[model samples]
Target chain A: MPSLIWFNEDSLNPEHQMVKDYADAPKVYVFDAPYLQAQNIAKHRIQFIYEALLEIPSIQIYKGETVAVLLQLIKDLAISEVVTTETPNHMIKGWQNELQKSIDLVTYPEIFPVTDHSSPRRFSRYWRKHERSWLTV
Target chain B: MMQQLRTDLELADREAIATYLQSEFPFVEDSGELSPHVGGRTAGLVRLQSFRLEKYGKQRNFLDGEVSQLSPYVSRGCLELEELRQWALKQSRSKSVEAFVSELAWRAFFHLVYEEEGDRILKDMEKPKVPMNQHQRSLPEDIAAGTTGIPSMDTLIHMLKETGYLHNHARMYLASYVVHFRKVSWRAGADWMYSLLIDGDFASNHLSWQWVASTFSTKPYIFNRENLERYAGSLLPGDPKQGDPFNYSYEELAERLFEGAYMPEPSGRSPGQYQ
Candidate 1:
């Protein structure tokens, strides 16, 4: 069964490392109507995403409820699995849970370096601890 | 089984994208073309390559600073902060790059705060170090109109409305003016700025406003005419045709804006510490 790679805003680049990892899979990006409506994201931002989408070749764009779109695509294409890059978003986590119920879903770890310490509320404290580890030449 | 709900959704060009967005989200007014700053991965790469890290550190605060106008791309995830950092380090290995790198770190820091604290970043991170003058939750119509009677701020507001961009120093000044001087809540000011900015990120924009409002800092950030002249004087041509509201010293500004709601630090802590 074929698999689909869903691209979130954080992982939009066609050259994203995760996209290379899923080279043979068909790619899809949903406008995520619920999230857009809930966030009331600015028009300029949507324009930016629209421009970015135009750059990617052979990718599908969907505009509707995220889980519903995924389910429809899965059934229509006989997709056995779904994959996407991991994000810190709680909403995405919720979507991932629903998507996992019907199909094999895999989320790659975030592309950036991870700190051993938990993220701190104060930037000064977080910087004091993590800068030495991450900011080296 | 796959129904083609919208294969026609492929936006052919910039014009098509604008039309689709306008029709789909009729509530949001069209802001016209974004600044010459291009979008997409290719453009992002070009921007990263063109940035001069050494100059950026020395001049980023000025109105015409040698800043890397990459925030829009970075915030949109067209370019990653780590990628930019690596590129900067590769180009030049010097402490000069620290300022530019720290700005990127601030972006990452804001994201971390948002991820961990979630919506709570929208509120005060800590109780105000100085008592706030309890103002309205909504932004004042005059400020939104860009007719605040302060020449520098009005000019900045006009530029923000016309071009979806503002200098970092200008942003802090405006944020300070709105939250502290005008006595508007930071949430109101943050919402207004986020809506207008092309580089708008919920984490960075709101959190920075909180920083200015003294909610996320040890003291509220305020600026007066002399500070503005040092950074933006060249850009702000002509005299204050209107009454110059911001033409005051630090003590006078603090006294007038805060109206006894603020107290001066005892002993060694000078008034300059507020800025």
Candidate 2:
């Protein structure tokens, strides 16, 4: 089953370590109209996204509902699964739920290491506990 | 089908894309020369490779410091905090790297707060230790127009509006001045700054404003003339001894600026103490 890599603003790097296995996979980057409207992202930030997309190879840019666009692409390309990098956004989580019903949706871990312990509300407390692990190498 | 749609855009460069977006979305401001540098995975990687951590640590607080202009990449997720940390660790064993690493930790901490609290981070993280006057909700017109008599702040506003970037120290100073001196709500100041910053992350921008406003921290972060002279003297226009309003001692600054809402009471322990 050929997979399609979906690139969002948070994970635009095509050469990300997680995507190495799917190096030859066709990638799609969507403008995510709903997300943009919700976020109220500035023009400069949007420009940054456009410039980044220009760097990656064979990435199709779409401006619409994410799930609808992905579903149509899956049908058109016969894509068995959609792989994307995980973001902390709640909207992405909702999109993933809708997406999983029709096709396989695989999310790679964040670029940073996730801590096992619950993060403290204060930065000092968080840093005191995680600094050693973070700085160890 | 998707391929055909992309083929139409395949020939488009950044300028064409910007033009198309601007025409389609009227809210999108024309960035002009203040347009942020082109960011891609390859460019971000190259920037990371060339960053000088030692110089960054030594002078990052100064206006003309050797700051790594990598925040746009970091905020956009082109570069990761963990990746930068690993690079710093490999490059040096000096304490300078500790300063740089701690800064990275701050970014990570902000993200952690945002992750755990969600939209709650938009409000005060904790009840402010001091009494706070509920201030205006909107950014002042003068501040927005970059005509705020204060030299350093006016320069920062111009820079932020034009470049979509301001040095972190300059950000802190501007944020502190807006929230504390102007008595504006941190939210207003945060929103204004967030709108222009190319590297704006809600977690960092909002929480940092809260920190400066004393909503997120024990004491408000304040800067005086002497402090500005030490860090941003080179960037300030004209003589400090002339008609500059910022040219005042810490005690005078505290008395004049805070108006008894907050004051720097001298303690026997330290030469310069704020209470």
- Among these predicted structures, which one has the highest TM-score? 1
- In candidate 2, list every pair of residues with a backbone clash: none
**Interface RMSD to the true structure, each candidate:** 3.5, 3.5
lDDT of 1 by residue, A1-137 (tens): 58899887765677777678778888898887666766556677777776776677778877778889889988878899898876555567678888998899888754444433377766777667777655665
* Cα error, candidate 1, residue B70 (Å): 1.2
lDDT of 2 by residue, B148-257 (tens): 87767888888887777888888988887887678788888997887778787778888888887778876677777777777887997644456655566655665666
Instruction: Indicate the worst ten consecutive residues by lDDT in candidate 1 chain A.
Output: A109-118
What is the lDDT for B255 in model 2? Answer: 64
Model 1: per-residue Cα lDDT over B116-158, one tens digit each: 7767777888887666647779989989889877767788988
**Stretches > 4 Å off in candidate 1:** A34-40, A89-104, A111-120, B1-13, B145-151, B237-242, B260-275
